[model samples]
Target: MNRAVHAVRRHAVMAVGVLVLLYLFLPVAVVVAFSFNDAAGRFNFSWQGFTLDAWRHPCRVPGMCESVSTSLQVGAIATVAATILGTLLAFALARHQFRGRASTSLLVFLPMATPEVVMGASLLTLFVNVGVATGFATIVIAHILFTVSFVVVTVKARLAGFDSRLEEAAMDLYADEWQTFRRITLPLAAPGILSGALLAFALSFDDFIITNFNSGTTITFPMFVWGAAQRGVPPEVNVVGAAMFILALGCVGGAEVWRRVRAARR
Candidate 1:
């Protein structure tokens, strides 16, 4: 009886987990499906039939490609800037004793806790008062401001689990600070740093609220999608969405495979 009850509980947990995953991924599945739809009109709603036209001619929609390019540029810039700054901040916070450290940590996390609407509005007001023009530069700056908090938070979590004794052992072997860091500290922290960077890029690319406020005349992909929604969104838009999803999935799969390979070798 106990064995039967245990099996039923395990099956129930698995069923719930599967349901939750399906709930999350059902929309993604639909997006991928619609990318191949032969839309009867500007609206890519109902599936008429499957066609690879959109995949073949993703740039067939004029401004769509340009907007995607802008998003990529902004995401890259923000990811680099945020990752560097956040990694440094994470190290300082985790490894040092300094004045106002508590306050500084609080400030670092404030952006994460604060609502995007509030942050966006505040940023806009600051820009207006400072007479900074709102455009691509402003968008990148805004993204960095928000994304840094996430990067720092992520890297800090990694640092918390780090074995400082590894650095000490390296030092005992007469390795210099930079050498110990280069050979030991960095390699372990690299996964966290990479994860933070990927997260920053995703946030920057997907951001619409903050970008919209700071974009002015510049259009990113999310902004383009928002504007297109007023009109009928193009099937090519779905193509872009599907392509991004596939690319992200590929990166994640590649990383996991690499991790498993490294683990097996160890």
Candidate 2:
């Protein structure tokens, strides 16, 4: 009876997991299906018929490509800046015992815990008071600010499980500080760093609330999507969304395959 109960509980848990996944991905599946929609009206929500025109003319909508370009640039810059800063901060928090260490950690996580609207408003007010113009630079700054916390958290999780003995061994083998870090520490931390960077880029790329607050005249892809939604979303927007979903999936899949291959080789 106990074994049967245990088996039932396990099956129940698996069913719940599958249901949760379906709930999350159902919308994505709808979006992907609608990307090929040939709608007579501006709204692409209802599928009229399947056509390859949307994919062929992804930039058919005016300002669509431009917004995508702006988003890409901002995401790239913010990811690079946040990854570097967060990785260093994670290392410090993980390895060192300094004054106010607890306080510093709290501060690092505060941004992540803060509400997006509040953070956005605060940043907007600060920029206004500082006489800083709202544009691409402001958007990038805002993205970096929010994304840094995620990077720190992701990299810190990786660092938490890392073995410091490897670095110590490197040092014992006549490796200098820089050599030990470069050869031993960094290689182990590379997975975490890469994961953090990818996450930062995704956050920056998909962000709407913060970008809306900071971007005065600048339009990113999310902004463009919002504007289109107010009128009637273009099919091109769906195409872009579908393409982004596929690209992200491909990247994650490739990374998983690469990791398995490396493990097998080892």
Candidate 3:
């Protein structure tokens, strides 16, 4: 009787895990499926039939391509700026000691800890007080502010496990500070930096609340999707969503393969 009960519990646990996974990924699956949907009107709620028109002419909807371009540009700028600044800050926090370090560390979490709506409103107010127009520049600044915190946290986690003795060994071999850092430090930190950059870009691209608050005339991809949703979302929107999902999946797969190959080599 105990053996039978244990078997039932194991099966029940497995069933629950499967159900939770399905619940999480069901929306993503639906989005990918509907990318091929041939909807006659603006609404893509039901599948009329399977077609590749959305894929072939993803830019059929006016202004979507432009919005996508804007989003990419903003994401790129924010990622670059945040990565550089955050990596430097991470190094400082991880490697050095200074007054106010504790306070700085806590302050770094301010962006992440604060609610998005509050941050957006604060940024808007700051821009207004500074007499800065809320447009592309403001949007980029706001993204950088929030994304830097995330990058700092990620790179710090990676650096925390790093071996400083490796740098000492390099120095013992007569390598200068710059050479040791370039060869030993930066290379080791590359994975974390790349991860942070990718994360920052994804956040900037998908962000709507902050962007909406800061972007006066600039329309990003998320904003465009929001506006379109009011008029019944277009099928092409699903196409973009599907493509981004595939790209992200590919990145993760490539990273895993690289990790395996490196482990084998080691």
Candidate 4:
């Protein structure tokens, strides 16, 4: 009777897990399905037919392609800048002890912890005070500010396991500090940095609210989607979103594979 009870419990646990997974993924699955939907006037899971016309008809919306291009440019530049700065900050926080360290850490994380609207409002105020005109540049700055926190946290976790003695021993062997860090610390931490960068890029690319507030007269993909939705989103917008989702998944999967490969080699 005890063995039968245990078996039943195991099955129950598995069933619950399966249900949770389905709940999470079902919406995404539905969206992808709708992207290929051929129904006119209304689209849903009940497939009226199948078509790829939506994917090919993005040109129907004026400035749609330009918005996508601008988003890519901003996300790429912001991610690069944020990753470099955040990785360096992570190294300093992990390796050095300094005054106001706690305060500094809190400040660094403020952007991530704060609500998007609040962050956006604050940035907008700062730009106005500084007389900085809003557009792609403002959006890039906001993206970097928010996304840097992710990079810092990720790289800091990797740094926790790092042995400073390796650098010390390298110094003992007549290697300079920079040389030791380049040869030892950097190689070990590269995977974490790379993963953080990919994550930052994904976040920046998908951002809508903060980008909307900071971007004045500059349109990104999310902005395009929002404006289109106000007029009832066309099927092609769904197609664009589906394509982005696939690309994002590919990037994340590639990062994970790279991380695993690095671990295996180590």
Candidate 2 matches the true fold with a TM-score of: 0.95
**Regions more than 4 Å wrong, model 1:** 1-6
**TM-score: model 1 vs. ground truth:** 0.95
Task: Give all TM-scores, in the order shown.
Answer: 0.95, 0.95, 0.95, 0.88
- Which digits, one per residue and each the tens of the lDDT, describe model 4 over residues 201-255? 8899899999988999999999988887766666677777888889878977997
Across 113-190, the per-residue lDDT of candidate 2 in tens digits comes to: 899999999999999999999999999999999999999999999999989988889989999999998899888999
Evaluate all candidate structures by whole-model CA lDDT and list the values in order.
Answer: 0.94, 0.93, 0.95, 0.88
- Counting clashing residue pairs in each candidate, in order, gives 0, 0, 0, 0
Model 3 misplaced regions, further than 4 Å = none
**lDDT minimum window of 10 residues, candidate 1:** 38-47
TM-score of 4: 0.88
User: Per-residue lDDT tens digits of candidate 3, residues 105-124?
Assistant: 99998889899999999999
